[model samples]
Target chain A: MILPRLVFESLLNRRSTIVLTLITIAFSVALLLGVEKVRQDTRYSFSNTVSGTDLIVGARSGNLPLLLYSVFHIGNASNNISWQSYQHIRKNKKVAWSIPISLGDSHRGFRVLGTNSDYFKFYRHGNKQQLDFEHGKPFAALFDVVIGADVAKKLNYTLGKKIILSHGVGKVSFSDHDDKPFAVVGILKKTGTPVDRTVHVSLQAIEAIHLDWQTGYKNPAHAVSAKQALKLELEPKTITAFMLGLTSRLSVFSLQRSINQYSKEPLLAVLPGATLQELWSLFGLAESALLIITVFVVLSGLLGMLTAILASLNERRRELAILRSVGARPWHILVMLCAEAGLLTAGGIFVGVALYYLIIIAAAPVVETRYGLTLTLTGLSINNVCMLLITQVAGILIGLIPGIRAYRMALNNGITIRL
Target chain B: MKNQFISIVMLMVLTACEEPVNSESLQATWEDLIQEGFTPKELILKYQIDTYEADDPRRMQLIRAMEEEWNSAPVNENLDNKKITLTGFIVPLEIESNAAYPTVSEFLLVPFLGACIHVPPPPANQLVYVKMESPIAMPNDGEAFSVTGIMKTESVNNELAEAGYNMKGLSLETFSNESLNPNTE
Candidate 1:
């Protein structure tokens, strides 16, 4: 203990250099730990997005894409399912209810989902069912709109507010759907899902806006006003896809089979749970990679700390010998040095964790918008606590080399050259 | 050190025995399953809609599950050729040229087999969209009997998920056209 006190004081005397090194090591540890925490928490948030829904039926596509467009409000469906196909599947005895969806349109950067009220009625996610209202209710009439939690907050919208649909997604939206301006009817609570950032409208609205427009984009040469569009037939001929639920649980397979085998359309049915499981397996590889990266980073930080202290051993030899001559035991000196190294590592990790929380609080909105990932600044996890312990132990073990050398040199020097 | 090594070996052994969630139904060819006494109910729960078009609370759960099953299958493209029964809806894709179902002809098969999006190789939980020669109309709660074709993966079009494992081609046969299986319950 005495030796460690002396060493801490000695390092303190060269406070400028030592403090710089300590800050560097602390930030590195923070980076390492931050990476690990973000990786784990993001995964948890992702996996917990939709828990209650039993199935996620969509056009035959990659599981990730299907999930993305349907639930997350990211990307666009490759094709649309025929109304005929959706109707046939919906009529199946096994189907409970259906939520018909028409995707591939956007209002500003927010995605516009062309879906029926059944989406609000029958949809379930995370721990709860039904979309909770942050301000208002679901759109009751056609041409009405319902904004997500983020959309509402970011745009500062209220009930009955009118907004136009942008032709494209992101900052630079091309031709606007000025003719079919939708009134904000609902504001959904923050679910930390993509829905929070989306603009929900009836399937009719989707068809109404695109009645005269061609695929990809409308001909800018023949742009029509919103009032003029009202007079035209806004009936939608095609939609991105439809979500089907069977009346009876047993009939889902038969219904899916029916849909897939449709003679008129090349279609597919998918169970959300099954595909989610599959997608998770695919992500498992990334998880392993993340684990490896985190391990390497943490190891590197510990090694750097060890290297710095060990390099300073030569300067500390005289101090150790002086202590030995003053009746300090060699073993005691070793313990003190190891303790100080351990304390430094533990202290650095602590600061790193604190910094991560601060960053999360600051960048929550940015992460939500760009990456579509929702992060919560919570307390330390058991895993993180374990990491702290591991850091402490590693610090002590690495310092052992220098600690032993100092002890040996002190014993050899004896009272003759205590200085 | 020796004890530590043994513990690690034991942990590895235990972890390796975990069961994968692949469909455990009879491994019949895609045609055989369709032709046989098809049980739609059992298959529906196993192969439901994959509302993973967007990253919502609903889709995230599906993505996680799909990722879990991506490792076992090396087959990604040409899903119809795999000779396994798939349960899904009739979704017309946007790729049909002069087909019966024009707009929604090229579609995906989800849930049971999700082609991974961002994940490198597509998850086996999805099947990529493919075009059939003739447009296949869906019977209300219908079932088809046909010999699925072989695998074909290409980097031509942007698919449902982000990347990896896109469906290329398929052969759709109407059930009324043939009696591959004679015996009926």
Candidate 2:
């Protein structure tokens, strides 16, 4: 009981240094937990990007690249599948539904996908949830287009707004499809998937906009007004990739086999789930590295506290001598020093958890829109509880360092008149 | 070259002379086939919608049953050689024309909204093989249209599927949005 009062008085004597120590530990704790939270949320959102799709088919390419282009819209396809191949596969008896995606255009860094009205009816994300319309309806005409939630919000686009697309997938491109601008007809609700960053147009419009170009040059003779182009055939010659949903869930492998062995063209069909698992396995190495780095950072923060407490021990020598005169033992001095360290660590943890929530609330919107990651405000997990306990234990171990130093000082120094 | 052009025009004019049966007098003669133990519900399950993974045992069983039923379905002989006007979604199987003007000449008419594109192709009986003499322009993607033609109870196999019925289509026109999907009829 007396030891508690002594510990409190000793900490109060050095309140400024103790407060600084608390702040440092709190910052470290926040960083460590923040990394863990972001990692979990990233995995959740990425895996949830495509659900209803069984296979993502594309022209023969690497599995990761195909997934990147078809699902994430991160990169361009190496090759394009012939429209005939898409039709043949789309019409397969085993294929319940297929949405052909023709990429290669962008509007302000966001990918532009050319598809049909069936996309609105069949495309799903986040555990088979169909897309909902925040405002307006699906594209009805060739020039009508639908913008994703992030696109609508970031670009400030609304219904009846006209937007032009660039011919290439660069952040900025000189060649623009300004002649055939599309009007935004629909804006989908936020999905926290790559779909949120896409701009959708009719497949015919994709063809219509490119009618004037042949071999990367705009031929003046082929140049026609949007109305005139509509009169001509708008069948797509090639598409970047397509996703297929089978009628029978048991026929997925068989259909994937058939698509892989397709006689018309060289094609590749990857099961989205399996490919995603493989991708995550590759990323596991980087994730562990990040975890290890954060852990070391936390350890260093605790060491800083130990250093602060040890430095203050020099000035507390006289205080300890005076306590010794008042009948305090060596162990009492040790307990008082350890108690102060424990109090600072516990206070730091409390503040750290509060700060973590504050940072998450502030950054959730930016993270969701920028990275397509949904940082759900989940409660402390079992692992996190274990982590907190470990952090507290580490603090106690660090506290022992200064505790031993003060114990030795109190034992060696007497209540004599020596400086 | 001029002579070839004139001959092609003459052939087109002759083929276009046949009149489609008036919609008022024409009746779907194959409507009886649908009544004979034919419900799309039995062939498909509600849980199977929008799923593509081939891991469900129930889905496999249902698909096998669908294929079996499709093979055993009896075609109506009365529907053969009859002129009718049918509305359904078009899946372009073949586009034919000179380089200057391309039009869809051979296509499949499906009975549902997303039959050929979004969903698995419907059973063979539900699909109508259409061959047009004067190919019409391809309509909007997955848009249903009315095809007036002489229906034939012919089985034709393509890379896509085996179509149970064929039609010699004469004219094609866009369907009014409300008139599509003769699910009731």
Candidate 3:
């Protein structure tokens, strides 16, 4: 009963040094937990980018590159699938519906996706969740565009706002589509996917924007005004890739097979989930490395606590000698020191958990906008709980070091020890 | 009791007097043919490539050319325009676009289960394109069914695969053990 009282009073006596140690441990714990949350959430966000589609068909290329360019709006396609090929696949009796994605253009720095109404009708993400509008409706006119939540928030776009897109995918644009500026007709609710950073427009709008430009050059002789271009038939000659939803899940392989062996143009079809698994395998090494680094950080924090306790053990020899004079055994001294270390660690963990929530709440908006990560305020997952338990066990082990030292000092420093 | 009896008699008389239209079409027997002979695996074996790499443009080019050549590969001509009933697994191609409850209208009937789920699909001769008059709700694509249809040895080239035979489906029902029995010689 008195053991805890003694330990608490002793810790309170050296509150400054103990507080410093607590802060260090708390910060380290927060860092570790934060890293884990980001890693898990990042994977969840990436995998949940596209769903309800059976196959992601693109030009013949590596699966990862195709996935990156088509779904993530990252990098660029080496070749585009011809419009005829897209039409052919769309008309296939097996396909329930399809969304033809025409990428390459960018509004400011965000990716511009040229698609038809089918994109809004059939496109799904994050476990078959449909795209819901935050404001206004989908792009109905040729010049109307739908901005994503991140895009609208970042660029401060409101409905009916005017914006121009650049021809290429690069951040730095040499030429812009100044002739035909699109009006923001819609803003989509955030999905925590790359879709949140995209700008959606009609397929014909893409063709109209490029009518004045030819092969990356603005030709004055072939200049077509936006009004004149609108009057002409603006059919997209090619597309970046497309996503297909098949009627039967079993026909996915057959349809994928058919798309792959599509004789008209060499095309490749990949199951999104299967290709995503392949992507994870490629990224597995980096994920493991991140976990290892966080583990080391946690170990260093525990070591810091051990150092603080062991250093304080030297100054407390006289107090231990006094306790020995009063008939307290060497094992009691051991228990007191261990208890103090354990209490400090438990307190630090509590503070760390509190700090983690604070930082997450504060940084949620910035993280989502900058990294497209949706940090949910969830309780400690199974893996995290195990990590915490492991940390506590290691703390107990670390406490043993100073505990044994205090035990040996109590026996050596008899009651009549000369100061 | 008398009123109920009279009403039942009048209903029977009315139903009996009605001429049964399309009775011949519904009652006609179909010739039972073995599906094993449709796709000769030996013919496809010769045309198979070792592996197809994504990076190699030439491999895909060769595959495209090989696929064209494979389309001309010999197929059974006797199955053309014959009223035939065959039991096989379905690989749906077109479905009604009801997100809640979808039904398959166009599908490719394959002899084996899971012909196109994961592994490479069978050759053109092994595949039969079947289009039903009305879409039927298939519990799953892997479930086998018996399709009675007019089979024509017409080569169908869709973006996904090529089928050597096409069938205009007349009726379809889930496969039963008794379906394997030859109904007609």
Q: What Cα-based lDDT does every candidate model obtain?
A: 0.61, 0.77, 0.76
- Model 1, residue A340: C-alpha shift (Å): 1.6
The positional error of residue A166 in candidate 3, measured at the CA in angstroms, is 2.0
TM-score, chain A only, candidate 1, equals 0.90
Give the Cα error of residue A222 in candidate 2, in Å: 1.9
Evaluate model 1 with DockQ and give the value: 0.02
lDDT of 1 at A45: 56
Candidate 3, CAPRI quality class derived from DockQ: incorrect
CA RMSD, predictions in order: 18.0, 21.7, 12.8
After superposing candidate 2, which stretches have Cα over 4 Å from the reference?
Answer: A417-419, B1-185
lDDT of 2 by residue, A1-419 (tens): 78877777777778887888888889888888898887777666666677757789999988899998888988789899999999888998878788988998899988899998788888987646898999999988889999999999888998999999888888788888888878999999988788888999988899998888875877778788877886888888988899888654334544776787788899999876556655666767898999899889889889989999998888777888888898988888788878888877887888888989999999998887666677878787666777878988899878999999888777667776256
Error of 3 at B115 (Å): 14
Report the candidate with higher TM-score, 1 versus 3.
3
Q: Model 1: how large is the Cα RMSD against the reference?
A: 18.0
Q: Quote each prediction's TM-score.
A: 0.66, 0.68, 0.71
DockQ of each: 0.02, 0.01, 0.06
**True-structure lDDT of candidate 3:** 0.76
True contacts kept of 2: 0.00
Error of 2 at A153 (Å): 1.5
